[model samples]
Target: MFKPIKSLAFATLGLAIAAPVMAEEVNLYSYRQPELLKPLTDAFEAETGIDVNVAYLSKGMVERLTAEGKRSPADLVLTVDISRLSAVVEAGLTQPVQSDVLTANVPAAYHDPDGQWWGLTTRARVVYASKDRVKPGEVTTYEDLADPKWKGRICTRSGTHAYNVALTAAVIHHLGEDGAKQWLEGVKANLARKPQGNDRAQVKAIWAGECDIAIGNTYYMGKMLEDPEQKAWADSVNIVFPVFEGGGAHVNISGVALTKSAPNKENALKLMEFLTSPKAQQIYAEANHEYPIAPGSEPGELVKSWGSFTADDVNLMELAKLRPAALRIIEEVDFDG
Candidate 1:
């Protein structure tokens, strides 16, 4: 009788057609620029039927997340610098991830002990020297930057910036407070300017012959080279991978964490696992010129051509914990002056 009606099946079919299935969606609060993450997200979306919605925040991400509280839509957080990652975790804005995939892909050194955040890629803070002025093997270590011989020649951004602070924290972690203070003072004496500009500006300063050497992240070399206007700035310097006196080159990371209020926890975890995979790491490295955190993941040819060096094994958590002390040291050293 129902089949004879020809209506029951049609009604059911119409109802099914009226309601469409939605793709799984995960929201992101990222300090990372949208362009920087699009390729990865696009790849992720293609592989998994999940949708990535990114709300890029240049600053105040923590404040916004805290304001949103439990009702927040943020499923994940991506940021550069370990200090930012540690701050998010310490602020209770993140949740610990207990995924085997994440644990397996990321080295213990690259992730939080509490599993709150994990590094995806790293960038070394290295020296950029004028090809005409600086000689090979002339500056081999971070300590060399402080030597009086380079006085009035070295350029850098404000010591208070997260990048420099992290490095300062590392110095404190390895050399002790007093030792770090001395090192900060020594490097401060070597500055060419009042520590005014960004890393790119430091390179530009070298190209302008305003300084013989500059300190910046290794990744900037690639970024500058890719920009038509900045290519000349990049071409002016020799990328040097400098290490700590007895340790390796100081490196920082671009990392990720799970939001505490993730509505789509499963999808978020999936995204987290995917990001640390070798494939994603390679994509990120090639896109951003960062060194992949996944071991044995090779960087792009451009990055490879920059040469390689030993990276310091000092736990980044230690550096994050020491950042406040490091900032104080920067102020005490009057490094900005």
Candidate 2:
């Protein structure tokens, strides 16, 4: 009876002051070029009203993040390939993200077993061969490229490149270490030219008649089709799905995860959910010519034009774990030597 209403108001004010303020911004460290990822980011901002500030870098995003430590401004990390993502996890840079949406959208095989990161989209490591030079159905599997007949006719990117390394790891998983090493040596014997440039370069080499066959991601063909100078490069070759009779096609992914010290945890999670939603998944497929991790999302016309194939069911995480061994085999074979 003695306490006035003003006293209660003062106590409530102290409680409010002690409560933490929710963050409104999410900082992203992405290895992808900003322009390529702008659509997704813009959509995320528009949908969630969360401002996304991105730092785009082609290299050393991991080192940069490591340097920042707990003081890092980053709330999320987006990058391509399992090796790079695993590196972030190994560095203790990412925290376990528990999200039912992500778990339901991305298969267990395509994500970290510990919920550290999730694959957003997948790219098949398929075959591209000169239409005139290599007959259809003649070369049908990854192992076929190692055939002596293809000697001095295959072109590929450098083995040190993540794509090649992942592909090598897949081979290891399929055929065991010794068998994979033998296959690597055989593939090396078949190189038309020294490994150089990215996957697209291998296709261009095919067009120039420098090689009769090459291994590359499927999306690169879509990119080439949209490019004028590279259109001919796309035209000169035909895509072949290398279903490993028993195993499936080799595949890799671009994935996302929340940082360990997320300043905007809720917003970071919201972005992850939105990105994996059906609509956002479609955007990823259409814009990047990649297969959506979410099931049943149709790929763009360009991707549809490429047709469909079974992806290698071997868990991609195994590839990340086997990377060092695969890299060693690459060196032993002198992939660039």
Candidate 3:
């Protein structure tokens, strides 16, 4: 029988290793940086007395897990981006996790139907426009970026990057294949410079007056403001949550999954449930400056200051299915060129 998660009396921890593993422990292979996860790992250890050993991987998580096979020690996998989570699932690296606590705490839209992965938080892919130049109503939707009225005024990373690909895929879902392709070509023709660099770089380009607007994830605004050198870049733009013509803003998630090879399945499930609990939700929201997956959990002050927008409810699995098509469209448009 499944159990309901009853209490969330977690004390904020300084989050260093609580103690050495003695009785029980769970191993984690995470694509998320250690700094972002330290607080959650600390709290889980405090609440359940289970030691969490996390291996932070910058890339190649699937390859590493596959190469290790069933001999692997990874009990849980944590990563940012739905596509990465989907990649792990496609590679047969994770297993289905059916838990009462999980279904109760996470909305069905944010978790896998088969329970292969559960989204922990969502980051909106929004437009950052020059506060001095682009007026409040100048740009309103993701589709608006393609208008010839804004030609030579947009900055972005390469179209093939996971973030853009996912956004492009959503457009494909709403529009037909031909519509998605035209939007890609339209936005590509409006580029300020050949797509180069990451989201933060796009904001810097906006700050430098290289372009009047740029497309980037919402959380990057919080990150830039924290860096003394990038504060000016952060100050130069107004965050705009752009919607699709008939839908809400495009959003993506950082998710967790149970590895097929998990040795400590019960303990791993405990940690996963704890992560979606209100207590752990706040810690992750505050740390990453993202929207919590758990209802009633609020985002950090800085993130709140940016205002909010409705998120599209298109199934993430649908977006995952469109990744290859999105990439094909990107290639067809010669977007980076």
Order the candidates by lDDT, highest first.
3, 1, 2
- TM value for model 2: 0.92
Candidate 2 lDDT over 230-296, as tens digits, reads 9999999999989765888888999998998787789899988888888899988889999997877
lDDT of 3 by residue, 8-106 (tens): 212211221223233477777788876678888889989898878777788888888887777676789999888999999999999999999999889
Give the poorly placed runs of model 2, Cα more than 4 Å off. 1-22
RMSD of each: 8.8, 9.2, 6.4
Clash counts for the predictions, in order? 0, 0, 0
Please identify model 3 stretches exceeding 4 Å from their true place: 1-23
Candidate 1 ranges beyond 4 A from true positions:
1-23
Clashing pairs in 1: none
Q: Estimate each model's TM-score.
A: 0.92, 0.92, 0.93
TM-score of 3: 0.93
The candidate scoring highest on TM-score is 3
